[model samples]
Each structure stands twice: as structure tokens, then as C-alpha cells.
Target: MTTDGPPARRLMRWRNAVWLAAAVLFLLNFVQRGIDLFSIILTAIVVALGFAVEHVETQTRRPFKNYLRVALASFALGLVLVAMPLLMGAGIWIGLILWAGLSGAALFWCTYYERTEPR
Candidate 1:
């Protein structure tokens, strides 16, 4: 036999839904407020993925320095590009788009180079 929930059970369902919605909204606001930090994180993750193409773990113990340098330089370049009058004047959205596109291109180039020209 199928069982239908009682009134209290139905309320429990609504309670869970409310909690989930609250959590989602909170996360959305948090991300919106820290977009710059998120952008940097995205760049770092892409750089790390590029390095993964060559099995970064197999490299020398000192390779971390090189990887860190590349990630930092990429992040700095992204910030500079976003801050330029050309992009900034376009609007914040445009600047963010440009930053993402540049970061992706840089990461892809890194991956391609590592794949074809092993050290």
C-alpha cells in the first residue's frame, strides 16, 4: 500500500526546501562579493590543470617554484588587463569577460607547450 505523509511530514518538506534556498542564496551573495578572489582561483586551477598534462608530481621536487611563478604572473597579467582603460571603460562585465578569455588562452597554451615540448 502507498503511504501519504501526515500534516507534520508535509511541513518537514517545506522546512527542508526553505533551508536549501537560504543556503543557495547565501552562497550566491558570497561569491558575488568575492568575485576577484574567485577569478584568481580559477586562473590557478587552470594553470595547475595545464601542468597536470605533464604529470607535475613526476617532476623535480623544486618544480613548485616554477609553477607558482607561472600562476602568479598569469594572475597579475589578468588583473592588469582588466584594469586597462580599454577594457575597464567598456564596463565591469566586459572586463571580466576579457580576463576569463585571456586566462583560458594562457592556460591552453601552457598545456599545449608542455605536451609537445617535454623538459
Candidate 2:
């Protein structure tokens, strides 16, 4: 049990490192591209990866309803983000902050509601 603890800790640390690296890379890509099409692509890829991670962690097959909900949420969020510059015009920064907050909230909701039992 003692030996297993160290191995488990090491694996956890490695997993964290991988996630951190992915986040940093995504950030760099967004910053370099100035949050246009590239940002959308990156966000989609990240979201897909997140879904995959959730699938693995929960050990359950994807539910159609959940997938539909996620897709609708993502589309709505993307629309808001795309319209932000035009809607706010003078306060683009505020729109960006709102977009970030919305994304965070959506991710939290998904994580919290994700089913853990096999389906």
C-alpha cells in the first residue's frame, strides 16, 4: 500500500502537468492569433478533449441528451462571443471577460452534472 501511494501520487502529478501544458499551449495559440478563427478552433478542440476526458473519467457511454445539451450550449456561447465585439463595440474587454466567465460556468456545470455510472 505504501509503495502504491508513491506511484499514484506520481501519476497524479503527471496528469496535472499534462493538463497544465495543454492549457498553456492553448493560451499561447489564442494570444498569438488574437482570438479570431484560431481561437474558435482551439476552443472546439479543447471542449472535445474535455468531453473525451469526462467520458473516460466517468466510464459511461455518451448520452445523446447530454451531447445535445453540450452542443447547444457551445453554439449559444460561441454566438455570444462572436457578437460581443459588435454588441459592446467600445467595451470589447468586458465582452471577453464575460465570455471567459460563461465558458468557466458551462464547464463547471458539465463537470458537476456528468454521469458517473456506466450506461
Candidate 3:
């Protein structure tokens, strides 16, 4: 086997490892170069814009909500991506602020969204 774990559990282990690696890299990047509002906004904008590619790949007309979702995420993240760097210095602190903002927005959204709605 290419991996050490059992075949059934290998995928999960790799996924967890990838997550850990991402966390470490994020920390390191924050400590070194900084939050990089431009980079984060650019990354988020690019990701959101990628919905066009997703649409093409799926070859299905999605609902308006999908477009709205993409737009809102881009606008919001881009806003936070800019604000955090300005509010906090260009350091790990910006990362913390961004994380807090995102978490708060998520929880706020969750509180209003219908819990009964199927995932």
C-alpha cells in the first residue's frame, strides 16, 4: 500500500494530514509575510469567480441563489480581507481578526437560517 494506514481508513488519514498541513502553513505565512489582504481577496475572488467554470463543468443551469452565494461570499470575504489588514497590523493578528469575523458571520447566519432545512 502507498500509505501506512488500513485501506479503509487511509483516505481519512490523508485528509486529516492535509488539513493539519494547511493549518501549519497558514500560521507560518501569517507569521512571516502577513495576512496579505490583497492575496486573500484575490484568492477568494478567484475562487468565487470559478463558479463559471463549475457551471460549465456541471453543464446545468443553477438557481439564482447559487449566483447570489458566490457574489456574497466574494464581497464579504473581500471586505474582511481588506478591513482586517487595516484594523490589525499586517501580521498574525490579521489572521485572528479574519477568523473571528468569519466565525461570527457564520454563527450569525446559522442562528437565522432554518434549522429544519435539510443540509
The alpha-carbon RMSD values of the candidates against the true structure, listed in the order shown, are 16.5, 11.8, 13.7
Query: Regarding lDDT, does 1 or 2 come out ahead?
Result: 2
Question: Largest TM-score belongs to which candidate?
Answer: 2
Which of the two candidates, 1 or 3, achieves a greater lDDT against the reference?
1
> Which candidate comes out best when scored by lDDT?
2
How far off is model 2, as Cα RMSD?
A: 11.8
Report the Cα lDDT for candidate 1. 0.60
How do the residues 3-109 of candidate 1 rate in per-residue lDDT, one tens digit apiece? 56887677668756865775576568667776577556655655455455334334434335345445665666666666554544655666667778877776676
- Model 2 segments beyond 4 Å from truth? 1-4, 57-119
Which residue segments of model 3 deviate by more than 4 Å? Answer: 1-6, 42-119
Model 3 poorest ten-residue lDDT run? 56-65
Ranking by lDDT: 2, 1, 3
Deviation (Å) of 21 in candidate 1: 53
TM-scores of the models, in the order given:
0.36, 0.38, 0.31
Candidate rank order under TM-score? 2, 1, 3
